[model samples]
Target: MPVITLSSDIGLNDYLVGAIKGQLLTAMPDCAIADISHQLTAFDYQQAAYICGNAFGYFPGDTFHIIIVNFFDQHPKRMLLAEYNSQYIICPDNGILTMITQSKPVDIKAIPIPATAKSLLDATKLIADCIKQMITGKKPDTTEVKDIEEKYPMRSAVGTDWIDSQIIFIDNFENVVLNVTKSEFEEIRAGRSFRIVLMRNSEFITRISDNYAAVQPGENLAFFNAGGYLEIAINKGNVAGLFGLQRYANASNMQNRLLYQTVRILFES
Candidate 1:
């Protein structure tokens, strides 16, 4: 039995997740079902894309990943059956699938799920049926499948300000993580003087310490996170709640929090 993993913005509060799993089991008895993550920040494609990209690699080969986020939201798109890195992903063609596999080569196919299957419940049933057919050694008919644009429109991984870094996602702990990697930041800060500034009250945090301990307790500091992305955090405070930094919700505020614009690094010789 092949492993089928499900991910989406659908919270656990409702029966949506259970309903999808029940449908999968009904179609393919004894099949393995796994939950990659159901709390995907509801309809935030980038968060879903990042979670799927980072977490799916840990699963075994032949895992069928089903992403059901933003299924009925604005901007209608097609279902996709893409094969990459020995795993198969079933998701919408709204570029989330493309972003996940941007660094690698993939075999893309547009799946034509019945339009009448408008609701998430109906779509899940149809998609599950299609996967069951594949597991039963039957190749699905793709004659009517609509092919997406040859290339996906994922924005370049590089930040809009190559010279400066962009604030991407902050964690529950209020750690400010930047889209720019440490290496890139180092290259940009070569011999140039800069400083990390907080946009909340225009407070200037000048010290770039090696770790949290490098700064006094309750002070703010910036360092490379485990993922190699530059991160900012208060020595012992919640940066987000304290600074009021919310992502995706407040678009204009995000631009104001840019490390270079809102926060800057001074590289002094």
Candidate 2:
């Protein structure tokens, strides 16, 4: 049986999630459907990319992923069918694809949608059809699509002594995940001591911890998460809520950029 993963912003409070699943099953019965997440924040493409990028790799090869987060970011003229790492992804023309892939996928094509079709279900139908073709070890019927929108994941702004990063995600426990990866951190450290500054110079985590247990309760600690990103947490406490650090979001406005607190890692010789 073919495996299809669904990641969408549509919450499970209503029938829409089931309806979309029904449409998929209607398109191809006997296909196994897996849910990656349903409570994704709409228009929060950064977090969406972080979540999907980390989660998609664990699944078996040939898994078809249907991403519905911010499906309406643009007019529904067409959607994108991307084949990367032997996995197939069907998402909107929005930049989430590039953000997740962190690069422009070489094998990408455009799946045209009917102009009259203007609903998530409408897009689901087309995606379901594409999966049917892909499971047969063939390309979906799509047109050559170059020049699709691109949005890369944010990275730390590096300096000789400091690296300024953003909070890409906060978990249910309120541990804040930064955009900095282990390789980036190590590259900047160069075997020097470092401090993870949260709000001000007065409050900081001076070293990387193995996990939350490495610190006393309510004490702050920093560690590289399983996804290889820097994460800040307080043992048995809420880091983001207590520190007033919000997820990174910039409307391209100066004021909008100030809404979230950035994670700055300072290195010392």
Candidate 2 error regions (>4 Å): 137-139, 256-260
Q: Which stretch of 10 consecutive residues in model 1 shows the poorest summed lDDT?
A: 151-160
Clashing pairs in 2: none
lDDT of 2 by residue, 1-269 (tens): 98999999988997888988898888779999999999888888889988998999999988888888877766778888898888988888988899899999998898889887878778778888878877767777789888988988877889999999989899999999999999989988999998888767578899899988898998999999889999999999999998788888755654745435588888999
Q: Which stretches of candidate 1 lie over 4 Å from their true place?
A: 74-77, 103-105, 143-163, 190-194, 199-217, 248-269
- For model 2, give the 10-residue run with minimal summed lDDT: 250-259
- Highest-TM-score candidate: 2
